[model samples]
Target: MSGDHILETQDLTREFKGFVAVNKVNLRVRRGTIHALIGPNGAGKTTCFNLLTKFLQPTSGRIFFEGQDITREAPAQVARRGVIRSFQISAVFPHLTVLENVRVALQRKYLGPSFQFWRSERTLNVLNERAMELLHAVDLQRYADLPAVELSYGRKRSLEIATTLAMEPRLMLLDEPTQGLGIEDVDRIRQLIKKVAADRTVLMVEHNMSVVSSIADTITVLQRGAVLAEGPYAQVSANPAVVEAYMGSANVELQGAH
Candidate 1:
């Protein structure tokens, strides 16, 4: 519950029926810092995110956000508390114009109980302006008027980030933001994430080591549903267990040497 930490988990565990997916996890995310969670497939990275965002409730653990316990909060409730998540797949509304899609997301942030379409034109325009600012922040302003369905794959991902920014989250949970991106696109997204995390906390599940090393202030290596090592990039990558887990013994010392 320290002010410097935006998120803290106390023995966070998630189970499916009788099987434990995310074992007792104690994660700490510093305020305004970018933290990367990396591991091989089935390492419980995504499940941890689900527990934080309330997409899945932990079987027996507590999640604290900004010093408040929110373990049993619902997904929408967690989001309203300023903890938002962006999925791996693009979640933009394909039929809507790019600008319109962003505007809709912004509206959702402020609408609360009202129906936006039924509101005044001025109100909608105000929301549109805010959305445009978010779009430009993510470098999708040029495609504002284009139908989202027609945007390139990378552009669509940018739009998704823009939409999430419209929510004005204090902490963002990014699940493989660069999963299918090419090298160039991946670099762009990495830079965007760095920019976004400058004044906010970001906890991302990224498999790309280069991307993680470039942007992450700290990296947590997870294995078999538990944290194997957590520290700065150099420290965690140098851990014998982490090196062995990723590339066997061959690539271990070599990567650490760098």
Candidate 2:
């Protein structure tokens, strides 16, 4: 692995009993770059993500973060090291107010307060200010006072991204960020992601070709748990193997349209 790589996998593999969910896979994400992973459903993309984030341990090979071996690191430890994941599904607390959810996330960095205690008015006020800053960054300040469950689907996802930013991550893992978003919401989220990624590295699993092409600095096409191709948007899109694996015969027609 190169010294400058922020994240890398060497022959990473995961198995459940006799079945291999993720086969030998190697990946290298450059520092401060947006690297996208694209693949079809059941192509082992999620499995590879789980293994990298330490949600599941790899059956073989190693994972390195910041040039250090972190293959067996606990998920919390990995996250604390500035690598955080924003789940595909909303992970916010629906019962909590939007501001409260963000404050909870911010307060987690300081272990002095018990999770059960309602923060003092002064402390809450400070946390609320910071939460609003993050909310505003994600274009979610207007919904900050509402109950999280009452927010629209797109807003809920925005809240998730805001909460993740409360941790001030150096590297972010995003899973299907634009899924289920309307065109407007998709555009907003895409811009929000780019804003957050200005100084941090973002590794995302995205299926939308338009989204990938718009945001990805480099693309890795995965198939059957391994990388099929890796390059810039135009290069990967033109690769015959990648086209067959994901875009299918229609890719030729799509390319013609472009």
Best candidate according to lDDT: 1
Q: How many collisions per candidate?
A: 0, 0
RMSD of candidate 1 to true structure, Å: 2.6
Residue 190, candidate 2: alpha-carbon lDDT:
85
Worst 10 residues of 1 by lDDT: 249-258
lDDT of each: 0.85, 0.84
Q: Give residue 245's error in model 1 in angstroms.
A: 1.2
Ten-residue stretch with the least lDDT total in model 2: 249-258
Against the true structure, candidate 1 reaches a TM-score of 0.92
The TM-scores, one per candidate, come to 0.92, 0.93
- Residue 28 deviation, candidate 1, in Å? 0.4
Which stretches of model 2 miss by more than 4 angstroms?
Answer: 111-114, 247-258
